[model samples]
Target: MPPTPSPSPGAPGRPPPERRTDDPSAVPSSAVGREFAFEKRHFDFIVGLIHQLAGIALAPHKLEMVYARLARRLRELRIKDFDAYCALLESERGAEEVGFLVNALTTNLTAFFRESHHFDHLAEEVLPELRARHADVPRPRLRLWSAGCSSGQEPYTLAMVLASSIPDLRRWDARILATDIDTHMVETARRGLYPAEAATGIPPALRERFTRRVRENGDTRTAMDDQLKRLITVKPLNLLEPWPMKGPFDAIFCRNVLIYFDRPGRTQVIEKFSRLLSHGGFLYLGHSESLYGVSSSFRQVGPTIYRRV
Candidate 1:
């Protein structure tokens, strides 16, 4: 899961999207089992489009998942069948709905500090080494990227850790870049608002120092403090596309985002990360993901954590 809340589209470890050209139907077959007619061709088209757009490779079994997530859009647009839906996507005007399509299929499942050990490593090991290395500098510069920041939680967590670990944080040029392919999640992260319950996973001291409770209308919510917000810049970025920013980031947290991509796509992204990272910078991956047989640019330093070699 990502920090902010972005697409955790489907379960991890399933096969990559299947490529099939044997059956090509412009219309749905005569199957009356569901609310919408989701033919294999429709699924295949979707698979191809999503892969092209976002680098997410959908497995063959994701047919139901794709149908279920996109069905609401069909209903909202008042489209009748999968053929029509696919046709619309192929249309010139379909460009607008493409964003919505990507958003709909993407799910952001995250917590304030979903993976505690990573934060522990950041606090205990990473920052200290950086501080020592930068002691001669007048103002140390630290940049971290929450690459798949879902809603906002991950980068905010990074901010908290930075604030607490570095006593001279104000003297350092510290910033966190939080980006997600889902613009909806990027906006959500920019707002820095979350249900009060989401704050539970955050450590008590960090939460108290970095977050505040706000009552909007009749509902209570948690808002990140300006101090923490100052350290983050949230933006929408597709990992597979051309990047605008120059990097050499001190660290990159791209947790749980790679599971949706096929091996080649995953390898490409990681290599890009490696290129953008500082020589000794760290790379963090989701628990179920690994760099094994993917790349040799990093050396494993901790559980799912890597240091650039």
Candidate 2:
């Protein structure tokens, strides 16, 4: 799919039908004091829609958070209440808003080498094993997938580590696929510009080599160097949808994303990853996620890291 464009702030192409004012279902009296009329029905629709669209299962506890996040959209579009907002989502005209809605609701919390140990393992163990295994290929290729890579940090970090580990990196074919369901985040990752503080987690040497400070709109920001950018391709991808790439990735980093999915959803996604992975390739998950009952295709080889069996 092509990159999703940002939604316009103007009202939807066509106005939603005016809901009956007297209907209790349209606007609950209890919502009278709130900034927007967010009833139980509206929350339910959001939960179901996000799950169907992104495979994210939001709990009931996230009701307030949902309202808080989506409320911004309401204000932006000049939408009166959740009733009209949900109607717009359900209508044909609302298709464009879908991207914005998903962008708003999806959580994007990432940093440069946020999970330090994963990179450590990649540099020390995984790279050595792959290096020895592909020693004979005329032009050995290395492919990695950072599934759910938010704002490009994970894949950029992967690029830095991959370049650092292999002395003949330029001689070999190497690419990192960075993807996220959120189109906005994909755009941000493509830009490869970040606040200076965001680079603190990266080692000083790597940071100095792979990134540089630039003035953007009068503020100094860190921009990823072309050397690092060349190794990564960022795209908007919904994991729940059919993937377009044919992959035999040497390693797949899908950290933290599975925590939002239920057991069955998690299993299905893991199975797809297993299919894309090269034999015995590595799969990395977040610290809180595990595949104990999700699949038997992998064996625990390190902390939250699995190797295809």
Candidate 3:
């Protein structure tokens, strides 16, 4: 009999294809990249560590989501693996790395007048009440804080409401202090530019008064009109850090930001917000969040809206 031919590489008759290791550190070139096999341990460690450090709790089920968000940082920093990335997070240069992590991990879902009810409350209830309280005061100034203000929408919305509803806004010394942990967002808010879609829910009269249309690439950019823009001053603020503002704000819109924080962090933030607010001022949380049992300083006034008692 002629010599039996050895089975060709990957031929059916050959020994079965070797199983690939699913481990990220051991994946072969022909196998899918390690990014997809991001270790659950790594994810758990990072999430737990972040929660411990900053009180941001990323759930265990968010492993894949977290990997997708932070994998780019690994590539950008030329790091080899998640472990190495975690090491970088622990180093002396960790502050900037942590910032990148925060930027990547934090959800920034917002639009102009999102949760329109809050704006309605601001216009119909809060602002009127604030004005009435200030009526007897000599200066009659109104101060609003949009804490964790993402890309400026909430603060800008507040400004528009004030401009439209408050007479003599230019003379009243009214101000909206909009702050976010992300510098990029702060700068974007400061620019006061938004895509036209952001204007959809805004009333036509207010849109006309508060937004100016400019064309670029045959698309319009709605620049917030000076009247509204002048009311908001955007700044970079870290909720985890000591607050820079000395505030006795009439109202605060800290919507959607506390979802990332754990119970203790949320409580701390609520206490801070309560302290920042004037007696009888308001605190607006995200629609999905509530202040029940979080702090004694606020009394629930509506769904996700609280009054400082």
Candidate 4:
């Protein structure tokens, strides 16, 4: 696929109709006395800032969500209004608050095995190939990356597949790098625990083998076992920034992450991934995402799965 130029703000092309952040007609009379009125200007500033910082394209209609999440930061900082909060963000020290804002605004909905098919593909197809390719080496070295590993489920799932696929994993050098832009999410993933209900998507035997039952503050939960924990490392990472690791990873799982980015941003990330991926490596994206017209670095090997060309 040929590379495309990034779109200018308010570009001439007829873009998709933006979903509005709020409905004026739906506003109740009782809500009129609110202290801070989130104006169109404030929303636009936020969208631009987030796009600049994280390469995430905030839809125009997500104003309500932006207002609601950032309101807590405003309250914490005792900022008088949305205008004042935005002005603060525009200031020099506003850089410090960027992480807080991102932590609050970014979505982190994930599970032990949210997309079961991806794991199945990894176990049945990808892992066997990796094992066969590395079989000759005494201590086979393998690396996998989970780019938007929200709360660590994706990497842990990958680790589970590795554990099940390869016999005598202790003799091999395997590592899964799990990273997220949200510091809070990275910390949560580092803790390696989840509510019992969050384990529903996990297969019964895998769940039994990997998570140990536990209780905290009268709430029953599950924690990743040592075997899974040893195979993974959780770190804070903003995908827009430079990555510190020099990796030729065997597989890179970046599912659902590109949905938040504009076309050019998506293309840029894919190209970067292409450079990081080893020959014949795999790239797994979300069901809704595709490589079509984005990059020719990969060939579609399955639904939402791509192999490096």
Q: Which regions of candidate 2 fall more than 4 Å away from where they truly are?
A: 2-33
C-alpha lDDT values of all predictions? 0.87, 0.86, 0.77, 0.83
Query: Candidate 1 — which residues are off by over 4 angstroms?
Result: 1-33
- lDDT by residue for model 1 over 1-309, one digit each (tens)? 122233345522222333353444432444346787676767777887788778888897777788888889999999997778887877888778878988988769899888889999999999999999999999989999999999999999999999999999999999999999889999999999999999999989888888999998889999999999999999899888877778989999999999999988899999999999999999999999999999999999999999999
Top model number, TM-score: 2
Worst 10 residues of 2 by lDDT: 6-15
Tell me the tens digit of each residue's lDDT in model 3 across 90-202. Answer: 77897577767767877777888889888888889987887786676766778999988988888988988888787866557798999887767888899988898888867
lDDT of 2: 0.86
Candidate 3's C-alpha runs over 4 A off are 1-37, 136-138, 216-219
Provide the RMSD of all predictions against the true structure, rounded to 1 decimal. Answer: 6.4, 5.1, 13.2, 6.0
> What TM-score does prediction 4 earn?
0.88
Compute each candidate's TM-score over C-alphas. 0.89, 0.90, 0.84, 0.88
lDDT, candidate 2, 1-309, per-residue tens? 544334324312323455676876775454566798676667777877777667788998787788889988899999987778887887888778877888898899998898789999999999999899889887899999999999989999999999889989987899999999988899999999999889998999998888999999999999999988899999889887788989999999999999998777898899999999999899999989999989999999999999998
Hey, what RMSD does candidate 2 come out at? 5.1
Sort every candidate by lDDT, greatest first. Answer: 1, 2, 4, 3
Q: How well is each residue in 131-209 modelled by candidate 4, as lDDT tens digits?
A: 8887788998899999999998888888988998888789898999999998899998888899988888788998998
Cα shift from native, residue 236, model 1 (Å): 0.6
Ranking by TM-score: 2, 1, 4, 3
